[model samples]
Target: MLWLLMTTGKCNLVCDYCGGSFPRDVVSWSVKYDISKLKSTIETRDRSPTVIFYGGEPLMNPKFIMKTMDSLNATRWGVQTNGTAVRMLPESYWKRMNVALLSIDGREQITDKHRGKGIYKRVVENASYLKSLGVETIARMAVTMDSDIYEEVKHLVELGVFDKIHWQLNVIWSERWDFENWAEKSYLPGLEKLMDIFMQNLSQGILIKIIPFLGVISAHFTGGYRGSPCGAGYSSITVTPEGRVLSCPIAVREKWAELGTVNEFRLLEDPLPDYCKTCDVKKYCGGRCLYASNEKYWGEEGFQLVDSVTKKYLRMVISKLPEIEKLIDEGVISKSSLIYDPVQDSTEVIP
Candidate 1:
């Protein structure tokens, strides 16, 4: 299981979607835990567990991060950060890092519109630096209504710094947000063009890994459930700085859903809902983000919203699988390229 440790509730960037907070929960709470307790808690694990460092900005507490890294016996370590504070980390830290997910919304204008002015420049610079250090930096984007997925993806491909890119559609947090309609109108069309380029790039031995496409395709080939859309409490769990353990980072802001404390942490015991039993697409989707599965957060159509996106990509994957298979047969792309490694949280590609 992956453990998410929220170091603090502080962030330097005030992105439109994030509201300038780390982990951007529905309700905001921030507390700093005892470093020794956090360290000992991680050390007590009998088996090597992969731990992910999260925060308002994890690097804001450099001392805590380094201390925990020194104390833990992690099989792999991951960090989700805004990318600006990378320089503050030690050279040894960068070398030891397994994966780093850096936030960047496609191109400069699109990224800066949501994140602050000049923030894109800072992140790009940091991404380049990470690349120079041989750090596996993955670019992450929060696709918004205005985002041109094709253009943004092209921009990311052209940047030539990121090893891969993963993205999520902006959560339908506002009641007025018509996410299903947005998927039909805005997302799918752009995805078509993006997939066209994706296949072409693969043929040319350049792999541009988009999460939804890679994720469903990996599930299809591997013949396994994706667990849940976001893998909330099953594959991973989150710990608040105050020692509260929750299913997801967003779940910590929720008062009614507290699973347990750090010492008493319990994995999600609930099975897939009854709706999933009847749904035809459960194999591909598993069930989307648990927190967004509500009527209040994503509207009564929330589940449908999740289904629409998953179905769109699943269809794309089905259509292209033969070609991908052909490429593998021709030794253009490795069969391993279609596999998804959850421990590393990355899609592999041999070019």
Candidate 2:
């Protein structure tokens, strides 16, 4: 199904790095649905696609949110949010919602370190509370340079919190955190450690659902998620808050085409071109992160930074197959759902 990012551009924190925080309170959803854009998407429904609640923090303006959701007749609804706001939502809101994903990070120390302290704890309590409330909670952690990943991950699962955990290695901007001559909270070395831990953990036969990082490997194993040479224009399309449509989320802001809005309901009719199909890494990679690719910060440092990270990850996954098999046989893994968590109590191979 198609994915509609039904969100207003507003967030609590001014994370200098995050794209969402830009232009400051841009889409005043309380005033109106980005009508021009919203109408365009709504009029062209993608066969009853899903409307994902992307946000600066969706709950920031709850009044307009219900109205916005009411406008969407999506076949399914998914939301990504920091758990803290969930508490503000009443019991009725929870029972009526078809909650898809709940985004929260690792431990108290690391998450709070990046997202703000005590934020991590509230997220934990929130995620656990959601699960207790019968909403399947998926833990989403953005692994960054400062993350003590294994340690953080271990703690989350070990605490017996969350229904399922998902992780994405933070895509450090090559321009901002380039491998060469960079010194601001960079984690090139730590990422290598993470790859090693991945192998070690995978050898133990547990799997973790990592996005983008495990892209090609995941594609191959799953038979395919989208398409080969799959850049946004090909396999997917993204719509901005202003109703600007583009090939992908990473495309230049000004280059964004004014596609119809969620209210109008039109999906991108065209797919990616021959360039995508012809690329050597198409079947495997689908092309690297577009946002990172277009960066002028690193200049030629792009390949050096991204390729190095991808290579280590791919190699680690492939080499650990035998160990993976043993872990599976021993019942340590179930459906590729574990990560390098020395902190978890240990994958339950036995009842």
Candidate 3:
């Protein structure tokens, strides 16, 4: 199991999608804790759980991070960061964690447009440093409308930078990913072609997980059942900086959610929505967001939104599975087709 041990809500950069503060008026990071009963609330178990350092950006509170690390014996430590703040952290910090999931959705242009100027360069440098210390490093790519997946991916291959790279097919998180022809498919021509390269290169060496896409192929070709293992609430848990534990990261504030706090946040009695359990599109959609499923947060509108995105992407995944499988069966592709990480390991430079 994975626990998102959030030490801070502070971030060094802002992007278009998925910031904890997007829905709130509060922009500054606040250090809040209801710690009077913290230890008493911690539930002990036979096995040690993996801890993931997630934050507005995890590195924003190095002292808090170190303190948290000192307090727990985790099976594995994963950090999701903006890269710039982490670069300023000491080398000892790099050696502290087992894996670092660095987000690199684009090169200078698209990256700078979203993250900030020179931020992409900072990530490259920080990754290089982490690898020097033998820390397993993986690149987390969130494909956006303007993101040139081909050029950016080729850059990684040429640099020999990442041991693995995970690709997140662009989804309209809150607002539509604004671009000229995004919904039209031709907006990003590299969509399929770059996927081919990802499959091709991944087959040759290293590892890459293209996410839910992997789930799709796993089901159709391998006779996978029942639902896409979105891994939320089951293998994955989300905790906010204030320490509200959620089922899936996207459903950070949905119904019957917030399992409890970091230590006590256990799964609810509800079965995972049928969409995750029975829908073929579950492989690609993961039932959309539970919060979106909530009538309070999104009403029928949210449900419809989830449906639209699911149907839209499921068709794409179904259409491309044959091609993805052909590549795999013919030895043109390898992992993500054969093996899946479910976020345990990512594709990035680790040498």
List candidate 1 segments past 4 Å from native: 22-46, 178-181, 255-257, 346-351
Estimate the TM-score for candidate 2.
Answer: 0.70
Better candidate by lDDT, 1 or 2 = 1
Instruction: By lDDT, rank the candidates, best first.
Output: 1, 3, 2
Model 2 segments more than 4 A misplaced: 24-31, 34-44, 96-105, 172-175, 178-217, 225-241, 246-281, 321-351
- Model 2, 258-342: lDDT tens digits are 3444344234443423334555444444334444444434555554555555554454545555665566677876535532221
**Model 3 Cα lDDT, one tens digit per residue, 1-351:** 566655565565777666434333222254455433332343364155667777667787777666666666667777877777775556776687888888887567877777767878889898898888887777777767676666766666566677656566454345543333553454235545656665565556533544444555555654443212434565567666666777665554455655776556676444346545756555444454444454333345544554655565556557866666666677766635455544364221100
lDDT of each: 0.72, 0.50, 0.59
TM-score of 3: 0.75
Question: How close to the true structure is residue 45 of candidate 1, measured as C-alpha lDDT?
Answer: 45
Q: Estimate the TM-score of every prediction.
A: 0.88, 0.70, 0.75
Off by over 4 Å in 3: 18-43, 46-48, 177-181, 187-189, 199-230, 250-256, 269-271, 274-278, 283-285, 288-337, 343-351
What are the root-mean-square deviations of the candidates from the true structure over C-alphas? 3.5, 6.9, 5.1
